[model samples]
Target: MGLTFSANLGFLWQELPLPDAIRAAHRAGFAAVECHWPYDVPAQQVAAALSGTGLRMLGLNTRRGGPGENGLSALPARGAEARAAVDEAIAYADAIDAGAIHVMAGFATGQEAEAAFIDTLRYACAATTRTILIEPLNSYDAPGYFLTTTAQAEGIIAKVAAPNLRLMFDCYHVQLMEGDVTHKLERLLPIIGHIQFASVPDRGAPDHGELNYPHIFAVAERLGWPLPLGAEYKPGGPTEPTLGWLLR
Candidate 1:
């Protein structure tokens, strides 16, 4: 079977409840789709869009906060707030029938932040059956972001030791932070529950950039990863023109 692909709604935020987008993805032959926080659209609307289009809901990002809000990861010191956020995210995921929730760690610095993140993760894992993914954002893209390295993420996962917690391996961030993609994937594949990608340097369609995606996909196939691969990139224009290569 081909790789299960998920269209990331962040890149197509202008068009939503995204019925047309889902139809387009289905016409192009994708099995699933994902989105960032869809707080603007009612959960029922999102569910309706999926039902009509025959597209499976892969995942969605959980909310952090408004402009001034530091975000859940930054609030690790506030266990009660973190727990509330995790609970809210899990409830949303359960509502949408989404298989995973990508928990974003906002920019928070210091050892205290680390302690809070670990503690919150343990609580989240215990509370939800759906997988929770912690993604490492690129420092350049998100300066002051708390989690930015595979090693750091692995360390947190090790400490949490929950089967429900896993890393959201974004190739774009990893490529920017550390260039050795294949080697790192080999090392972290077992712990990775989900994957996302964008072209390096520009965060566009996969084929437009330096990373060799076919080879990467081949490696993933070899590893027998059963999860969906997230198409979390900006389209050069319409998504189809940029993603034509994947259709072949």
Candidate 2:
């Protein structure tokens, strides 16, 4: 099968609302779309937009605790809040028929944070039919991010060991934190819930980066991974014009 791609609405199409962004993604030839947090807009509205556009709503992240907060999944003191966030994300994802949900780890550390991460992931895995994703953010962008490397993520996944709990291996972040992406992608393909790409260092687009996206794509293809590579990057300007890579 051919490679597929998801438009990350969190950064792309900033000018449009959630509903319009879905439509824009469809027009741009994306197989699916994802958002950071769409709770502000009613789930029904986003669902309608997806139905109208014939585009899949891939997945979305739970709410970040607000300004200065990255996420809540690793906060040991906020277990109730984290579980509640899971329920809310489940409702929205189910409403829109999204197949997955990304559980953000935030900027947390230590034994407490690890315990919290395990507990939150366990709860989310038990609560929803949709796949739960755990991503490792780069320190430069998310300093003190709870999960920072594939090995760390693997260890967490091993501890959680939930069928539904899978790692979200983002190329941009992984490349920044650890180089050897192609091998890592091959090694982690079985448990990767989602795959995302952007230009390394700057996060401009998939092309013109320190890492070669085409080679990575080739590696994923050889590995027989069957999912859309999410275009999770800052357009640097307008999202529409930066999509020349798609045509190429």
The candidate scoring highest on lDDT is 2
TM-scores, all models, native as reference: 0.93, 0.98
Per-residue CA lDDT of model 1 for 1-248, tens digit only, reads 75777778778433545656666777777778887776666777777778888788787776776585436755655677777777777887787788888776677878888888888788878888888889998988788889999999999999889998998999999999988999999899889988999999899888868899999988888888787788888885666677765675
Per-residue lDDT of model 2, residues 1-248, tens digit only: 67888999999997799999999899999998988999999989999999999888888998888689988989989889888888999998999899899998888899999999899999999998789998998999999989899999999999988898898999999999999998899888888989999998899888897988889888888887788889999997889889998877
Error of 2 at 219 (Å): 1.4
List candidate 1 segments past 4 Å from native. 68-70
| Over 4 Å off, model 2 | none
Tell how far residue 25 is off in model 1, in angstroms: 2.3
Please give the CA lDDT of all the candidate structures: 0.80, 0.90
Candidate 2 structure lDDT:
0.90
Best by TM-score: 2
Pairs with backbone N, CA or C atoms under 3 Å apart (clashes), candidate 2? none
Per-residue lDDT, model 1, residue 221, is 82
